[model samples]
Target: MKNNKIFLIGLLAMVFLTACNEDVLEYKPEGLLSQADVSTTENLEGLVIAAYAGIANDEMVGPITHQWVYGSVRADDAYKGGGGIGDVDVINRYEMYNLTIPDYGDWMTPKTWVNHYKAISRANFALELINEASEADFPKKTLRQAELRFLRAHSHFMLKLLFKKVPYIVETMTAEEKANATNDMTNDELWNMIADDFLFAYNNLPQSQDEVGRADRSAAAAYLAKLRLYQAYEQNDTHQVTSINPARLQEVIDYADDVTGALEPDFGNNFLDGFDNGSESIWAAQFSINDGTLVSRVSFVTGLNSPNSTELYGCCGFHLASQNMVNAFKTDTNGLPLLDTFNDVDIFDSVDGNGKAPLAPGITLDPRIDHTVGIPGRPFKYRNTVNEAGDMIYNFSWARDPGVYGYFGNMKEQQAPDCSCYVKEGPFVGTSKNVDFIRYADVLLWKAEALIQLNQVSQGIAIINRIRDRAANSTNRPINAGATDVYAIGTYPLTLSKEDALKALKFERRLEFAMEGARFFDLVRWGQAAQVLNGYVAVEKTKRDFLANAQFTAGRDEYYPIPQREIDVTGGLYTQNPGY
Candidate 1:
């Protein structure tokens, strides 16, 4: 009996020893673990914060790259020519219909692509880890998942617009899978993926975020609405009109209405100081001036490039607002668009001594003009006025030859004089207040656009009028004339038919959202991009020698060629765009 008991004890000891050995084999070093370890509820939150931080990088949301690529690289805006205008010149040439093989030397295309994908990859990694976590962390799981999904969706959306046939990688695939991957999906497939992600975000995200600039339900819906509108356009290959889903369009209208009450009473508040949290902003790039990390590339590009600056514009030179763009704001007899009289007016009015008047028209002339352009009298939004002499000296080259190259810095958000000088610290010293991503006004306009396309013209008109009135009286609605100029305060009365109202809506969008990065895509989705851009370029070339080289042809120039290098890397597995 004693021998049998001892044998049982010995067997139990052997079992315990084997189990301990298995546990030791399973142990992994902290650094050697998969992304699943680093992307926990605690660790992954920092990654979400890092996603926003990445935008301030020079290649991503940084001001110079963002503004130059999105703002000036369109038909309506021109590059102010000077000795250092190489980057602007390249953009204008492309905007004016020049196409080339992707050398990858162009920092704009490759850098933007890399930045967007990095953000996407980070978000993708977060999603992968969050999904693998336990249900006890579900709430954090849901929120982080939604945020990462929103980021991934938006990054892909931008790529879809630019590259058109980008590989739709949802997960971090192996090198073998990536090599085998191809962009065989249709535009509809791409749009569907974008819509699905946004819908998930809209359904799960909070109406507002604890911190500003984070994704919310309204922003997701707004983006979804935009994607729907783009899909509604007619397509070439399928010969099928991407009809608007009434149900989907109504979803957009309902979501847009959800935030109307949250909008600021004043439209200009959406763009001015202390306006970061105003109701008008559905979502904007979060930047804290006090945090001392808010860097803006747009502020650098548009601010006064002066004596101490080595930027493209030493003074204020780049993104010269064209006379045509300004003229688009003129009101008709009934305080409506000068659609019929569009070509009748002289846009190049002479400037007075203070760089104000006739050339520098008052907001009273057209509130939009005042909002977008810096006339002689009003303060420029982003220029360094304190060091005027220095600014003049640095930007003298462009000022001397405005006609040859468009040289006029945008003044929407200027840096302080002391920080105006370019240094190892940065191109500008002040905090970057300019938006690098979405804005509330953009969301509102996007809703207005979708509504108009859905035959909800009157509703769309109300939205636009709200924006105009904001600029008129520093309020969102019309008021009794007092200190404000009533004539300058144009009434956006909806007297036209549904068809005509659509045109008016389009024009209003062009005027209000001008140079804010949506123009080219807006034109493309509306099916008028080819005609409008080409026609404008031709007419401008005839009118100005500087524009003589600027010409656009439809079809071939409508979409850019897939970077040749990407295609080569895929060994012809990836097909190029039709013309490219």
Candidate 2:
């Protein structure tokens, strides 16, 4: 993940090159496979598989399966916690939202740009092969090609989210065309191009695949729904939503209607290792441990996020939850969230509903907090049974630097140290549990957001309350042993106004997907990133000194600056994002 470790993630083509050092003996490297070795008509599937692997590869610093740095740290859901602000300081730069120019010499975002393109390149390479072959020659030609394009669009979509004006590349492009592909396309055009790939996949892919990891029709539909939802919030050059397109909102609802996925019966089922490809998982990046590979295909995105307990998770604790996020879960007398005044008090010291009384048994909060965050003196990952390290309660000592970041750790993506899926590589802990890119809950929420934007207020609130209902029933936890409350969470009434429904819908998303790396992007989509995040830092700076100088610039900070290295590699053809 560091600059020194960059070579380990060499492009897909690097494996095909003949490394013939003239002075040394070189005979095509005995164990390596050549392009011809894997490119035969019968083995064309190999190229497709390689494309999947390109996206599946996870490293903490790169844009891994879960984009914790881009989504969580950039938003109000989390703080970039580690040894200090200097530990993986590029993320610290991101958290602070300044000195993050294209040529700032930070490798994290640039490496993420490269990693996405690597995945895109693999898809293009496979597409080039498939384009020449007929369905008669390759029986699964259309199906495989659709899947490859789905992967290609996925990478481009993530790139668009991170850096808005990324060049859209395809297999049809000539060498010159590829070289000169610039970040000049209008937002609508680029979004349409990415959506075109998903549109094709949605039309061609089957409803199910023999391999659980493979993309299916429902996955394509879900992605199309997601794409349309983002596209609906039409933004200008300044990255502010100019208008919410009603047609696009309708498309989100229609595409969502085609998505045949369901929420897990219990909310906790979605995060458990045993439910990797459960009903709730519309599409996920499959991972594994003890699969006979050198180090196992375990998730490395949150590798640095395990608790710093030596006997337990071992190393760094990075993506810790924010006080604003924890407080967002607390409910008032009606058991509804305290939307406006939630962040008035820190999680460690919460006042009563009126903001006058100290915390007591009556400070009811959503039980999903028990599942999303790890608090000291509380059960970790719903486990009261002792772990292999002989600890169940989240120890206060597990936090790496609570003085820098609050004493809350991200919990949804993590596993217990004793679990078979758990693997500790040195100090970092990783799990083989699949990371959901599109959860059934996400599909429902996307429709809800679009509906609210389109003025279907009650329908949107109805959809959001489904998630809250699941949260209320997710109280099957190790009895919360902390001083904070975990009493009750209630659903919203249907009589709410459109504006209140929008607020409730957005709040529901923040609480439901709190630590799953989606908050910041949601804020950006809603054009509320600056107001919400700057307010978060204003209060957070008082508690954490590292955020004293933090600020979120409206025009520039909406999207990350285009990587300078990308522009250099393109012969300066790529234009940097605005304000960079």
Candidate 3:
């Protein structure tokens, strides 16, 4: 009996020892990585890569980078143009400026806050890791840190533009410090701090990077110029324009002088699929399709703006160009744009009472109108084709609801369905088209704005004419040019008054970057939002009933509110912006 009991005890001990073996206990979980795992030079490069990855993500919040919904629709350039307001109800409310604190669009506000901070957090982590490693340990330590700082500044700039108040976070902050971070910095301090990161990047980064998408000195210079341009236009707490600093304007020109990229000979070159990351592109987010992945690494941020349920494009149409925007393309007999009188006559006006017919056959229009907008009877860029009777014309039957929204479809943001860059995911069509965050033309325009502000009106006129020359000479006309309507565009007159030059600069920017999302910011910077947007609503309400009673309050509508969720998470460390 004693021997049998001893045998049972020995058997149990053997089982327990096998289960508790070191090999079994110390095994790492599948696909999990630790700090030590990524402590090498190549691995640190990968970490910076991860930080860059944050900007090119699929989240609407993070890089909500595409400004079609927020910039274009909210401004006068576009309509909330999906099936109806209900297609994305939040967008409708945003367009109307009737957003509530707990409205659905407010959800995007918090998400944007979270995403920008998430990107900043990644940058902070990379900086910390880089700090621990020596130059001998990491050969590209300085460049990597510069790149990360540029990214961090980029994220912060986006936040600053969207939300007037944000908590700035950096690597040195302890968890408690981060939790206690507040938004009490003065406007000048905030702009200067953000500019410091770009200045550091501009000093440290190379002229060009071996990797395609990496930040270079030119990119840093361009972004710094943009930052300085915004800084030059100072605003009060109530969002009224207090002053435009002449010193800061000179700074914009100085920084813009550093950008050496040339304008593409053809303006259309900036929009096509194959022309991405061209010489004109100072910095662009990279995308890839057919890189051996099941799904393409493309941005669908503008996917919803594609025409609804058509063979040319497969989904919702959300960024329909406003009739007002379309009319802004109208040119007078001498081939100059109608800066003041464009809105008096709608593009759809016809001899008969009905306004539904195609545009008048011989009416002269700016050539850029063909590239930036899709008219009903004209050729639709690369998608021009022959239908049943074999007459070539791009159809607008795909427009979700032309009665509610105008008939003009956004053209620059989409690609031809037949292009290699095009991809379909369920009902939406996405493309690998790189969004040109900053272009050389942007540098020119920024410099022009600065020059004009400094009373160098004639010099600014030359720059403005330089841009108009490119638009006038652009050769991206329809395949059957003889069959298309009349196209006319010309440069500004050599001599112009200071007032006329500024108006020319403003109108030129509207045309150059129509759907690319610079409209609202321009209006805000020029201290014309109340005058321009209020007048816009007064007229637009007659066209779009949805905008009835839509008001742009001077103090309240300048910036969106700080997210309520962020306030809750920080336990009230952050204060809400005025008027929510």
Candidate 4:
């Protein structure tokens, strides 16, 4: 019997006969169309949609769009919380920086390189085809070109951060030209090349787009600020920051000023499903479910990170909050973070097997903790609303393997299991929620960073305090406000010294953006990866034995080794990054 409700994905394929190779259709092979047939204006615009789809192709482990593994698990923010050490061995190796492994055939490394290049190829193809069309045929030719360039630059920026040195591919390059391309650009030159794309995008893109998902001038401005912030830390071939570029820091401030209302009034709004594209959002990858489509465009990339069998969410659990992260939320008697001694006490000390850990009476924590992480006895997201029957609980029995991975659940990525947005695809669970690639809070933090590096330490402290003040007042808490847990957060001291101000800024970012996949990258840019991570390993090893022998080498651990498959494809044209 044929099922009428079952839809086929074959109807949505996009076929392109490229001048370089007819085999290019392997990536997206649905509709049959020739490149020569792409001369019409409508066909040119369709190419842009195809380019946008590339970012959504992220599933499981995309080094481009999803950073759960690379940025969070690889840092101190999260642990590889699956079944056990042998569950996903490659990821476990990555968590330990076990690069000495001879076999680099893991699926993530090559898949990351391939998926990003696939997006680049589409943008390059679109650009060439758009050029062939007349301005009369496509009146918005410049705008389309600008959009495609932004996509291309975005892909390159993702690659640069993950691989450090990647070939700069453009539409001007032929198939033969690209095959012979190499990752030979100097660090400074590579950054400038990426900056050029964002600069072009900033000048040509409109202030707002008619489409909800399109990148606008403000998005371009925000991206340029991010790029400039990274560029301001001038690094040498060895991946060490040689000097700080003052002019580049100034550019960050200049570009940040051009961005409007990038910071939302409430931090909770940024994590909700519907308010994803709000004014505070600089840019986000769009997702839709039940929108007359066969399947959702939802991000299944972090599917493995959901909670285990429970009433709230039934599935695997791959990314759990580290004890270090939980401890970092502890505040002093003055309602401020005990930055130096926060790690002295463990949050799990009072917990029993049922995952019930009651804080001492009058104990206070930042309200953001409930929004960012799911701890036992605490509400998950706003799941504890007044009208609901009960709260969405994070039960210790819900953990896949609590003996190894802790009982903490990731709240930011998962919706209530009973919510319409949650989709149960077999044993795994996913959600039709938009993923923010860059938000306004990120821009504000970047601005604060620039101010600190420019010697305006007081101004930087003020900006950091503003974020703290927001977190202190953020209302994303359990609806049934009880006296069990305290919510106390204080602003930074205005008379802070430069050294103290720097420490405060770093701590604030950790508390503000925990588990959102920005921790490792922040440490790297600050040139503190070695010191910070080594210290983390020392303390955490006493908690988890898998990390007892883990170490982070200064020169080697800064960037992941380029996939051996990519190097093989280049036929020795590409040189391996240092200490690979």
Candidate 5:
């Protein structure tokens, strides 16, 4: 069955050809229309769907290999799995850190690159076909084009974030165009193209998308803000400390503020299954488990589960939250990261197998700990069940040997248990939950970060406090006030000097966005990757037995070696990042 799935994916690639030689399709059907037949507006929508499909593709945003692996795994939030060749390679070795190239054959690297461009191509094709269709109405055409532009810009932005110098291909370039293509643009030129694409999307897209999954003007604006922020980081890059462009940072402040009004009052609701279209979600990848369609099964791959759940092949447990990540939640007496003492906390105590006092002095921890980590003795959001023996069982654990399992996994956004049955044999599992691409709280935090950087510390605190207020005061049934423990632990008497305020914002972002794939990039942008990662290496060597056996460095290991294969292909046309 696994071979069959791979074959299907291969066949699908042939059906929807891209300018690039590689194919992005993960599955193919037994029968399908020819490429020429699929060139019309109605037919092209399927292709457009295929493009969106890439975001949810296992290699990209989908469950098995979300960008989170690169974003969080390389940072402190997660450790690589413990077994197998690839498993040890990713987790233990520092050399393969940002493994996003075709040569490494990480599956995710090529899939991510191909998927984004595939989606962009579909959007481009959609715009072209719709423009020629006589029956298309002006409003529909305009909206569809706006949606396409947003998607194109979104994909390009993602590529730029990962590979700082990807070729900027706006229109669908032909094979001849590809032959002449070169990584000729300077960093500024590439960023300008990104900015232009996003601005076009912001100007043309609707404030809100009619569909639950499509991008809106606000999403485009948010991307623009992020792009500008990144570009500001690249202004006269000296690597040691690049100054943030004030003009560009101010633009980020304005654009982020424009979307701040769309925030939902309840922060948790923004992640609920039915709330994919909630006020806070500017954009999300849509999935559904109905009709046995494997298209909607991303959650099954990303959700926390044991190694041997029968519903899915024994491919669970990739992104295990680390002890350092868990420690980040503990606050100091002054309500700030116990910066001086965070490393002093004993994280292993939260689990029974490890020794030391429980994170706090109890069998359980503050409620937010319960909400975030799936330590023993804690109930997950949706996995509470009673067995025939009448003992409550939290099904978050792996079904190891079927009847003998009784452990918990992260249950914050669990889909039905049956959702995993869709894969039954392969590394994939089908889940119907919508994956949020952008949420209002994130935008709020981004704005807050920008404001702080711009010297508006008080305003930044107000924005962050708004998010905290919702988590603390939500009247929704069984609100866990302990989630606010961090606020009290870290924010009272918030006395911070300008530099301290910036550092606080960084810590706040780390805590708030843990396990969400934002930490690594955050470290990079702050110019603190070398410091934090080196600290992690030293501490891991002294404290963690498993990591003690590894070797790593700070300056050389900070940026990933541009996949060796990419260098070979570019043949000196592209320069590798320094120290790679």
Candidate 6:
């Protein structure tokens, strides 16, 4: 009995020793990477790529790159045209200017917050690794570091625009430091942190990058100019532009001067797929299809914004350009945009009853309107003729909810059904066309805005005329030649006063970048959200009664509330935005 007990004990000890072996414990799965594997030079590049990929990590419900929901739908450019108001009701809250709670649109607001920070975190991780690497061992270390910093600043800038306050997570932060990150800083301090990252990038990066989507020094300078322009409009806690700093406006002018990129000869080319990364695109977030993955990296940020046609690219119709938006393109007798008297006349009432039938006349529009809006019966994406299936025309039936939203379809983000950029997953139609993060035109306008604010009125007016000239010459398209009477745009006079020039600059921005999702942010940056949006609703509600009693409180509605989940997780270390 003693011998048998001894044998059992010896067998159990052998099994335990084998199970606890170092080789067995340290075995990594064939497909998985170990910690030390990421320390190499090539893997460092992979980390940078990962950071780039995160910039456009958007979905139908949560858009990180495209701001149609937060900027367009929230502003006068469009409505949340889905199945109904019940579908993504959080977006309705945004559109209506209702007082927001932290959990409101959590899917969208928090998701976007997380998405931006995710990209920032990836950049931070790559930066840590790149900083440790020697330039001798990894020749592109400094360059990669600059790229990572540019990306980090891009996300932080966006977060600042959205939430007004966010913790600056840096690579140097220890785990404990990260845990205690707080959102308690002056607006200038936060802007300076983001500006510091951009300054480093501008100093170190090349004028152009070898890769199409990479950020170059020119892109950094352009972004810096944009940042400075926002910073120049110093705001108080009540979200009022207390003072416009002249020095910062000069910075806007200087940084914009350092930038380099030419505008596309045809303004319509900016939205076309083949023209991506062309002269006008300073920096773009790239998308791909048929590249070696299970599912190609396509743009699902606009997935829900497709037409409702079963024969065409079918899905829920969203981000429809407002009647007010369509009317804002109307030109006066001088062929210049009607500055103040635009919303007084509704285009639908003036045209064919509901804008569905053939036009009756008496409306002259900016030629760029053809590029910005998808009017029913107009040439869909410049296709004058219908296909054999009879579907090229943008029909009124394309609207998912016509009674609630208007009849216009968003044109800029969409692709023609036959184009290679089109990709549909389930009911959602996504595209692979790159979203131009920074365009030359945007930089031009930034410089113009800065100059005007600095009281350099004539110089700014000249720039305004330059943009208007592009719009006037946009009538060169043969597709729009038959409708030449409807398309007319004129340049602003250089002798105009600063006040009139400022108005022209503001109106020009709306006409130039209508559906690109920057209107609401523009309003907020100018500290005109309450006045402009409240005024918009007063007139627009008469047209679309969904906004029956809409209001935009200046301080509260300027930025979204910081996500409650973030605050809770941090043990209330993160404070909510004012008036949340």
Question: Largest TM-score belongs to which candidate?
Answer: 4
Tens-digit lDDT track for model 4 on 1-580?
1122211111222444222333331233234666666656767777777777776667786556768898999899999988898887788988988876323646776678778878777777788889777788888888988888998899899888888999888988776887788888898899999989888989999987867678788888989999999998888888888899999999999998888655667778778766767888777776666655566556688889887855555567889999899889889887789889888888744566656666766567877888888777666667655234245655567678877877777888877665666677877776767788888788888888899878898888888888887887786555223577778888877788878888888888899889988899988888899999999999999988878878999888888888776676678888788887
How close is each model in CA RMSD to the real structure? 12.0, 5.6, 11.0, 4.1, 6.3, 10.6
Regions of candidate 2 where Cα sits further than 4 Å from its true position: 1-37, 350-359, 482-484
Taking all chains together, the TM-score of candidate 4 against the true structure is 0.93
- On lDDT, the stronger of 5 and 6 is 6
Alpha-carbon local distance difference test for all models = 0.55, 0.81, 0.76, 0.77, 0.54, 0.80
Query: lDDT by residue for model 3 over 439-493, one digit each (tens)?
Result: 8999999999999889998889899889888888875556223343667888777
- Where is model 3 poorest over a 10-residue stretch in terms of lDDT? 1-10
Error of 1 at 219 (Å): 1.6
Which portions of model 5 miss their true places by more than 4 Å?
1-39, 60-65, 82-88, 91-108, 127-139, 172-174, 235-240, 260-267, 291-315, 333-336, 348-359, 362-366, 382-428, 474-495, 549-559, 564-574
| Native-referenced Cα lDDT, model 2 | 0.81
Q: Candidate 6, TM-score vs. the true structure?
A: 0.92
Q: Which candidate wins on lDDT?
A: 2
Per-residue lDDT tens digits for candidate 6, residues 1-580, read 1111110112211221222111211211121345466657767677777777768777877677878988899998988888877887888888888756778545678878777787687687678778888888899988889998999999999899998989998888877788788999999999999999999999999998766678889999999999999999999987789999999999999999998888788888998878877888887787776554556668889888888887888788888888889889888888888999988777643225444434447778788877887777676677767774356666777878888887788888888888877788888988778788788999999999999988899999998888888777775553342443476678888889999999999989998999888999999999888898888898888878788977888789999998898888789999888887
What TM-score goes with each of the models? 0.79, 0.92, 0.91, 0.93, 0.80, 0.92
- Deviation from native of the Cα of residue 110 in model 3, angstroms: 1.9
TM-score of 3: 0.91
Positional deviation of 88 in candidate 4, in angstroms? 1.4
Superpose all Cα atoms of candidate 3 onto the true structure and report the RMSD in Å to 1 decimal.
11.0
Q: What is the alpha-carbon lDDT for the whole of candidate 5?
A: 0.54
For candidate 4, give the lDDT: 0.77
Off by over 4 Å in 3: 1-31, 60-63, 102-105, 349-357, 387-392, 479-484
Regions more than 4 Å wrong, model 4: 1-31, 101-105, 385-391, 479-481
- Looking at model 2, residue 506 earns an lDDT score of 90
